[model samples]
Target chain A: MTIVAKFEIPYLRFLDSEGKINKPLPHFAKNSRDLISLYRTMVLTRTFDAKAINLQRTGKLGTYPSSLGQEAISTAIGAAMQPNDVFCPAYREYAAQLQRGVTMAEILAYWSGDERGNQFAANPEDLPIYVPLATQCLHAAGIASAFKLRNQPRVVIVVCGDGATSRGDFYEAINLAGVWQLPIVFVVNNNQWAISVPRTAQTNAATLAQKAIAGGFAGEQVDGNDVIAVKYALDNAIAKARAGSGPSLIEAITYRLCDHTTADDAKRYWDPQTVEQAWQEEPIKRLRQYLIKNKHWDETQEAHLQVECNQQIEQAVTEYMNLPPAKLTDMFDYLYASLPAIYLEQRREVEI
Target chain B: MSEITLVEAVNQALAYEMQADDNVVLLGEDIAKNGGVFRSTVGLLERFGPQRVLDTPLAESMIAGVSIGMAMQGLKPVAEFQFMGFMYAGMEHIISHASRIRNRTRGRLTCPLVFRTPYGAGIHAPEHHSESTEALFAHIPGLRVVIPSSPVRAYGLLLAAIRDPDPVIFLEPTRIYRLVKQTVPDNGQALPLDKCFVLREGSDITLVTWGNMVYETLKAAGQLAEQNIQAEVIDVATIKPLDMQTILASVEKTGRCVIIHEAARTCGVGAEIAAQLAERCLLCLMAPVKRVTGYDTIVPYAKMEKHYLPTAEKIIKAVEDVLSYEG
Candidate 1:
């Protein structure tokens, strides 16, 4: 009998939870500039996430998903892509959306139930966040097919949850990308839980990254709490896709420190000891420790950054509250390029 | 100008559009070298090259989603599902994303793609291959549902669907793909959408139908004419954004109407047309408006298909019932 094939999922980690450098630094991390910017953005995201949950608690905002421990994965993908490339993200990718020029106010308007919020003026090419699980994976493959067809260097990076990898849309999407050799990357934020369903129950696979192997592409894992490791994985994958080498999948291991959303309470289904353990390895805290230990940040700078983030978030909240109410006709206007004659009376009858 | 079958006319229309617009591309299972299961996309790959003509994997959701993405990026993709029964796997994308993207994004991004599939029962194929569940798409707000019953209409309407600026669900009636031939010019002309084509004019009754049922309805109209009933035949080309004005005017003159369709009787497109007549032409309708449609059960297998499809005989019976009504 002849042996068929062999595959292995490569893992990477630059900084451990104790602020110790475990792996050699990538080019961007060798200096402090990129690391500082990443830290700043992660802090911004963490601050924003807290404010959003607060608003939901006070009945000022709708149900919101908190990216408590997974900021590094979103921030790393956003920072790694070029302006011309596209990003197709699932819900809870505020860090990436913010870096791609989606304003905090715009994000607020959307969560507050306004369609006008999705029309991004600065990032027109990027897709609006898809709430349906795993659907964006196929859209990213489609967008990448366009880039491949036009002989362009643009790549598409799509983010999904660990549970999404169980859906057929995820497999079908990666299959097309692999077969067509499309310029795209599938990033799975394996945050250990989907709402109430644990990762263990989601799939029996040893690692979520190995799912890409079935599609004939490389797959790997990273310490998602380590911002540098997340950034390094995206950089390598994005470069390969841009050069038309094909697609890759990276399963970033992290944990959802908060409940699934404001509508949920993790205390009901989660273990108290497990939740406390996850907080120690949260992305923002681990990265902040790494920055301080590496001498790139200090107590004085940390104090100033916290003050600035709060001020910025307060300004955005004010702008979001002051923005004009969404017009009643907005629902009818964007429905089609030109409204058909039959809908004229129906459009006229629309009321608030 | 050359006479061709409905399927041949479809092929010609696709070739014309891909030739006229470089942005137009085709994708589906077995669409490239295999031409297509029905040959409607034959010769397109050879002419347009693989860049514009692609054979996608056998995943309906990906085909629908990928085309939406491509359309958002300014490519006009005409994606075909092998069969309408197989199309349900992609219904989530069609309903949740393709139909909602433009409206949700406030026109910043739009999906201007076409989802084409062979629909309706008649050929002695499997049960899934024979369905007229077009009402499912018609119920979607942002999608335009277009069906062509004849060769000439197929050529013109398909071209218009490819050119329409919104997402379109273009269902071709497999029952009539090769049932008839007519001289259809290859001219790059498109018919108007969201309007009904009034095929014949009369005052005794109005016979309204679409898809392969158009043949059965026309036959009923001809038989009604022999009886001096003088039925008006309306070919409702586009089911969504229905042309109720034409049907209203006809019902006003005829004082009676019979709506024909092959989908299930409950909540079918026929029900929509019947309800519209009751709303807009209630006073003009001197008699009653009746619906001649398929049964409420699942579209049956091939051997039992004829009993399920609305026939010219059933349509004639319906017209007679409406004509005899005193209300």
Candidate 2:
């Protein structure tokens, strides 16, 4: 048999597990401020995640998913996208959503089962968190299609998990993106686990990034624990899409360092030793190591930043807890643009 | 006004909407070049150009999900499924995102789209090709499930479905797509949704139906007219947010009712109508409500299609049974 096609997936990592610079720093990393800002946001994300888990444990919040080890990936994505560009994210992108102007209270409100949480007042245009896996991939393609049709220089970025890659939606979306040459980016947070199922069990493909090749676009892997690499890949992909060069896929290979959600028990499926070993390459620790090694950060700065993150999270939590319950009629009021006359009678009987 | 078939009327409505609104777009498999599997979108690709009439890859879920995304951006996307059977692959998107986006976002984001598909089990189609599961969509809160019986209603209702500010499931009856013709004007006047259309007036009994079953029910009404039964026929156009008041008024006048549908007997739209009539019109009724529907089994292939579909004879029988009640 003759080979009709050939392809390769290039891996990228600016800093290794020990925080050693593997190569010369990219332009963004050469400036200490950019890296420091990224570092600050990631730390805030981790702090927020921990506080969310604590709230869930204390019966203050509903089931919540923590992006404990994958802060770099989500934070980098939020930084890469512009304000006008749409973000069609699956659940579990709190870091990105926070960066995109969604308030911590709004995010908390969603997990607490209030309809208003999805309003995204500041970022009203971005998609709300949809629970279904990878279904938003097509939404990204469709949003990109609109931009292309209207000749707007806008990009759409959609994120999903490794398990979502096994779904037809992911494939169909990437395929449509390729066919239309739509302005979109598909980012897979290959966090090595989809709840109890591991990456190996989710697909037989050697790498999730290579899946984009089948869709007639470029795909590559980035060190999700390395914020510089994640941001670099996202910046390139978003720029390409904005320039009308079509779509790209970036597989951010990170590890899920926490349970899938408050309702899930990853310890039942994960090995203690394996979890311990993964901590060595967690995003925040390596970034902190790099900053400290470069003298851009000191013990005094780190201690003050931690206090600020805690104070911000505490204020958001206080605001969220004091919020009033949504009206019972909110469900009916927003069911349509205006309630149909036929449903008005039924709407009146909406009792507890 | 031009006399056109039901499918032709659909094409007219789509063409009119695309010309009137720049945000209106069409997307589906084989829709752009092939003019749709049923030719309901004929000449759209040429008229609107590729930018508006997009021929997407053969993926049902993507068609639906992408439509929601496009709708969120202020574009009205009329996405087509090859058949009602193919809609199962896309229901998660429709039921989850399209139906819930408005409520989930508290009106911040909305899905203003029309999901069109051909339904019902006549004309000798394949197994998965013929499906009439309108109840599943009607049960959802944010959706408006519409099925037109004739060319005029099809044109008016389709125009309305596309213009409505929310998600609408426009299920065209494949059995009657080209079965009959009517003088439908392309004046761009959309028929009112959430209302039933009275096809015939009578005092003896009410024949409530929509889609292909409306044809059979109307035929049954005619047969009853020959027998001096004088049956009233009503097409419940928008099944969800149902125009029950019209049906209730007709039932209150006729004192008897027979609900007919092409979908399965179990948990069908007919069942919902019958239940509502029982609750609202029990005091007005002269007889127990009856339903004439397809059986609760797989929609058979070509050979058994005639046996599976509700016929004029079966509708007449159900009407007679309801009329024979002696309360």
Best by DockQ: 1
Report the lDDT tens digits of candidate 2 across residue range A145-203: 88998999999999999999999989999899998899999999999998999999988
Instruction: State the lDDT of candidate 1 residue by residue for A1-352, as single tens digits.
Output: 8879999998999988887888788999988989999999999999999999888888888889989899999999889999999999888789999999999998988888888789887888899889889999988888898898889999999999998999999999989989999999999999999999999999989999999899999999999988899999999999999998999999999999988998898888999899889888888777788788878999999999999999999999999889898778878888888988888888788765
Return the TM-score for each candidate structure: 0.99, 0.98
Q: Worst lDDT window (10 residues) for model 2 chain B?
A: B318-327
Model 1: how far residue B63 lies from native, Å: 0.9
Q: List the residue pairs that clash in candidate 2.
A: none
lDDT of 1 by residue, B69-101 (tens): 898888899999999999999999999999998
RMSD of each: 1.0, 1.3
| TM-score of the second chain in candidate 1 | 0.99
Best by TM-score: 1
Worst 10 residues of 1 chain A by lDDT: A343-352
What's the residue-level lDDT of A41 in candidate 1? 95
Residue-wise C-alpha lDDT for candidate 2, range B209-282, written one tens digit per residue: 99988888888889899999999999999999898899999999989888888889899988888888888878
